[model samples]
Target: DETALGTLHSNRSAAYFAIADYANAIQDADECIRLRPKWAKGYFRKAAALVQQQRLKEGVTAYERGLVFEPTNAAMKAARDDTILLQKVKYVPYPTSVMAPAKE
Candidate 1:
């Protein structure tokens, strides 16, 4: 049963993520996505691992792809929005005062 196998891969991906093993998580997520192309969970797992790796753009792309299959997924939508914000923040410069040494 391909679907069951896909579920198992997705579960493994989640386990890898829990252990902070992002590369393996992504690998398992990719397998799950290959086995179940229409399943949003695989994409979600991939996106999460990518985000943890600081690959924000790739994470956003994965989330967008998942949204195509489940447009009304609120959790995915929130995560995607948060990632977009994080990406924007990454390029923003901190205020000079924020980086200044404190006075004694």
Candidate 2:
């Protein structure tokens, strides 16, 4: 039951991340991790949210922590590697918020 709830939260976090709503994505991913610490997916979601929010080091740490719990999770391992590779490249984050015209 707890895992199921955590999965729901993780799924919602992914959706929020897809929309560039990194703040809410982090919140939902945090809850998922709290609900299911043993689930690799929860950690993956949290790490993804953290990376999107420009906290790359923290996100990689989260991935490492998750890997400790599931050493053989291929998807998680791939995600971790991808995150590292992305960090190595010069990343220019896209603006997620619209800007208003400057006041005269």
Candidate 3:
């Protein structure tokens, strides 16, 4: 099934993460990690997928693992903090009209 896996697959997984398909993205990230365990981005991507899935606890754990290898990654730290805060706040979606988009 190696051929079933490709950069396109990884890219699609990232796209899924962008669109909030967390579970499916995690599946792709799973294969990516299996194929490239030493690759830091793979774990980082998985952490993002986990966060999107609302697996915040495990996502923070994953972020910690990634930090062990990518200590200088600022984005990772910000995301980790964001994940942790999700547990602290009880957010309710507000109406878009209340906060309109910024002017271009």
Using TM-score as the yardstick, the better of models 1 and 3 is 1
Task: Provide C-alpha RMSD values for all models, in order.
Answer: 1.9, 8.3, 8.2
Once fitted onto the true fold, the runs of candidate 1 whose alpha carbons sit more than 4 angstroms away are 95-104
TM-score of each: 0.91, 0.75, 0.70
lDDT tens digits by residue: candidate 3, 4-95: 46455667779888888888888887777677665556678888999877788888888888788788889989999998899667465777
Q: Which residue pairs show collisions in model 2? A: none
Candidate 1: pairs in clash: none
Any idea what lDDT model 3 has? 0.78
lDDT of 1 at 13: 100
> Residue 34 error for model 2, in Å?
0.8
Q: What is residue 86's positional error in candidate 2, in angstroms?
A: 3.5
Of 2 and 3, the candidate ahead on TM-score is 2
Clashing pairs in 3: none
Highest TM-score scorer:
1
- lDDT, candidate 2, 30-61, per-residue tens: 89989998877778888988888778888898
For 1-104, candidate 1 gives per-residue lDDT tens digits of: 99999999999999999999999999999999999999999999999999999999999999999999999999999999999999999989999999999999
